[model samples]
Target: MKTIKHFLIALMSIAAFTACEKDGDLITLSGLEQSELMATESTVVLTQETSAEHALSLTWTTSTLTVSDPTMLAPNVLSTTLQVSASEDFSGTIQESVESSLSHTYTVAQLNTIAKNLGATPDAATPVYFRLEASVGANMNPVYSNMITVNITTYEIDMSIGFILNSDQEATGATLYSADSDGEYVGFMGATAWYSFFLEEGDGTVWGNDAVSGTAFVTSSEDGSWNCWFPGQGGCYYVDFNTNSQNWSALWIPTLTVSGDISGELTFDRPNVKWTLPFTATSTTMTIQVSGTGNQYNNATGTDDEAAIDTPVAFAQNGSYVELVSQAGDITVTVPQAGDYTLTIDLSDPTAWTVEAVEGSEEPVVVNPNVYLPGVDDGISGNWTFDNALPLYNEENLAYAGVVNVNSLWGYTINIERDNWSDNYLLDSGDATSGTLVFQGNTNIPAPTAGLYLIDVSLNGLTYNLTALGNEIWVVGLDDQWNFNMPLTATATAGEYSGQITFAGASPWGFQIHLDSSWNRYFGGSSGSLHYRGSNITDDASLTAGTYTMTVNLIAGTYSITQ
Candidate 1:
């Protein structure tokens, strides 16, 4: 004889549980008062004397099912339960079945026990939430009443402390707990870039930066003190706030590179605050080493993120999402496969940073093209129209010369970067024939006439020689590798000629005038005198290393150097 009781019990609750109220069907909750559970005593103070006394009574009414047959009685198929919680939302609750009852009475001792179990502190009045749950046949189709609150004061005991922290004082914030109730509260807070905040003790005391300059000080309980802040990137930090000391501390983690057992270095994404390196693992898995400077223990001072950490690294470790420690840490995030992958270290958040491994092939390496100066040759451009410029001649040593096709008389500027206005060069003195050159100088030689010409400019000695290409006077001795040369315009008297020259060079300077590019015939003599190769003429006393005006009538044998 196989028993049928077991089978009937198993299928009783959900047995075709449907709304087909034909002859004798269950029509649950047809006419019930739509309200919350009600408590007779809304508040109570539990004591040893009142331990046995009734503290509170909770009652709720719910209809099981309604049917058309008036002669039939409602079946006792519905079950009710009593739920009590110390939270308004009842995020955590304690449930006790009331069988088929409609009301439950709690004694002082029983109510006190429930409150303490729900984390309510003794000797303080804490609000507890209560509601009734009605269901038919093994908790199917459960219906709940509105929640009610009952404030109860229990006996005394030790409870941990907590402090509220906020980005804005009057705005939303979170709480950090102190297990020992010692004023020091700790919690995980997301500190973002420039996330200035404050902390408030349970007694309504506010704490913040002490407003001191260059100090790791904090305000004891000042409402108008400077705002508090995180020292470094402020990514997710395991933060600690000490209400007594008024100071806070967290590891100062500086931005670092991600390397070790990888192909190359990763580039940092400034906008996203992350570093991503893509590569395939060499073996079964990949290892990453993140090593950098950080504060080990002491709170960072003004502008010194890790003045105290005072080491290459304070703390670190392996595994995903490792809390940054204030000691030497060896961190290696997981990369299961050895194939292609892109590893990323995200530090975008001011509160914390994260490491992630993404699957991918090798990303293309970008090569930035080189930037070159504009090319200019005298014939095509820069002939004098500002269309092109005369730069250093064939990368020569300050010998700026260009052959230009000129229809009329025109002047040109010279610069390494052809178009750079700040560095452009011009004649500082004299006419188109010859003169001194100065940086940003605004003078140009109005050459006697313009045809195909060679504009040779040397800014080293601040001089330029505009020669008619055919007639050129090679003035030597200005520079060892160069010449103190300038073109001399002829006079109607032929051998008796006059010209002007401006000279500047190192100390103990002298000069020799050559008639042609050849060193065959030269004149070396002091001012107002002339000599045919008679010992080199020198101005080591007053004329050397100084700017002077030199005017000479070579044939008349009269020259003057005016300082």
Candidate 2:
């Protein structure tokens, strides 16, 4: 902190700055500048060698306390805003506020950003200014520290860099940052296309593609650099680059599919590095035959096709789980006959990628879930009260089904409505698709991907499967139109659905749910439950429809409509 002479208030007054402590007296803090801030270092040099360490730290004594009365408690300002700037007056610095903190540490990346914002060139010696401002209780005025100047020799390369973007030679507003200053930088960007781009350092250093059409992520401070393929086919991609490792990858896959013995596609969960497929094994031996399609890309060289499964994603048994390997070496293991399973492929660690098969029960196992679908229609965001939970009563076939919307951060479960979880439910394996269902397990079954899925379980088979479903479902058999009509749009929450329907005629009516615009798949059921192509859902005892709302949750395979 600068000397107190300029603040027009002596630092010694802080010791006696408390108010009169009267109930009616305004609790005012002493002055706008009442504390001395100390800096650990004033002159520093920033280099990649020292990037991981703090360049300097700013700390200040707490502000004077305020109290309405002697008997009342006094609390000092608990928040502080640290301002750094190139101009001594601080007209150009970025404002960073920290609560319940008294100190601010500077890292290379932060300083680098400030340097650019202040018009300081990388590797140039410059003076950066810092100050702290805070407000105490009821003090309309914020107390600020005396401005302090720090001389810093910026690193040659801006710790925070930007991309030139698809067609530009100059860096766009797309800046990426290294959280640890250890060379790993990650940033998210949405592009109509992200196939080409160049990395631009603060000092105007251009890092781009090498020859051979720039197919690799090979970048060095030498000759073969300028602009390169950022390693993705295109979409909003999560890009991670490490200057230390000189490697980078951008992955974005909106959907995935599994064919052959198991068939269907599922949504790709990018953050979790996983995609799931639920199906049943026809025999003890089966081969997963297919590839991934739709919007996706991989910028990692020689692995761009990784986005599409490349036709060689054969998973082999490896101890407790399975892993993707060359199709020629695809190994087989004993799979429970007619095993219902959820197949998951996780690529969080590109190397050692694993395809785990979470198995449920097989035919004749006699394992039944208390409820076919017990879930939170609003989603897992609130406390779930398995109220009116549906039970599996199809003893002849013992097949139960429903749609579950696991939301973004949670999974789903199959249980009944009872005071206790154990007594109300029968089995679950947090994310199990095939193996034996744990009896009365409290753990929820995690969706291979956190979203809407069609869950199918067979009691006698003791097997369960989850098929990913889109939100384009429609309402049929209403409005005297039974064709692919009346679209029930999807809500922000997957599987949880909503729409409106009008009946030109009569009371007791009926409707059916269509998976898509086609009649190839539709559902029919009664009493708040759904059935695949079963019968017309017309069991409502009293129904006089004018224009009613339709609420459907595929995850729970339930629906309701009313004015």
Report, for all candidates in order, the number of backbone clashes: 17, 20
lDDT of 1 by residue, 158-201 (tens): 22333344434542234556767788877555444334567655
Residue by residue across 1-563, what tens digits does model 2's lDDT show?
Answer: 22222131222224334443223544433433455778998887777544434678888877645443343344343456777778887674565656466777776545665666677776778988878877643435567778888887776664454433333443344556654556566655433222356665544445654332223555554555544553323333446666666656654444445665556874344334455666667677755543433332334433244343322234455665454434423333346666687666655442244665568622222223346344434355465556434334243345555555544334445553354555433345434444335546665554465556555666556666756677677887775576766778888865677988777653223567887665745676555656565444553324565778888776566778778
Alpha-carbon error at 467 in model 2, in Å? 23
Candidate 1 accuracy as lDDT: 0.53
**Candidate 2 stretches greater than 4 Å from native:** 1-33, 40-44, 47-57, 71-81, 87-101, 105-107, 133-147, 156-563
Which portions of model 1 miss their true places by more than 4 Å? 1-167, 170-194, 200-206, 210-216, 219-226, 230-240, 263-279, 295-300, 304-309, 314-333, 336-563
> At residue 8, what lDDT does model 1 achieve?
34
Angstrom error of the Cα, residue 189, model 2: value is 10
Question: Who wins the lDDT comparison?
Answer: 2
- TM for every model, in the order presented, reads 0.31, 0.32
The global C-alpha lDDT for each of the candidates, from Candidate 1 onward, is 0.53, 0.55
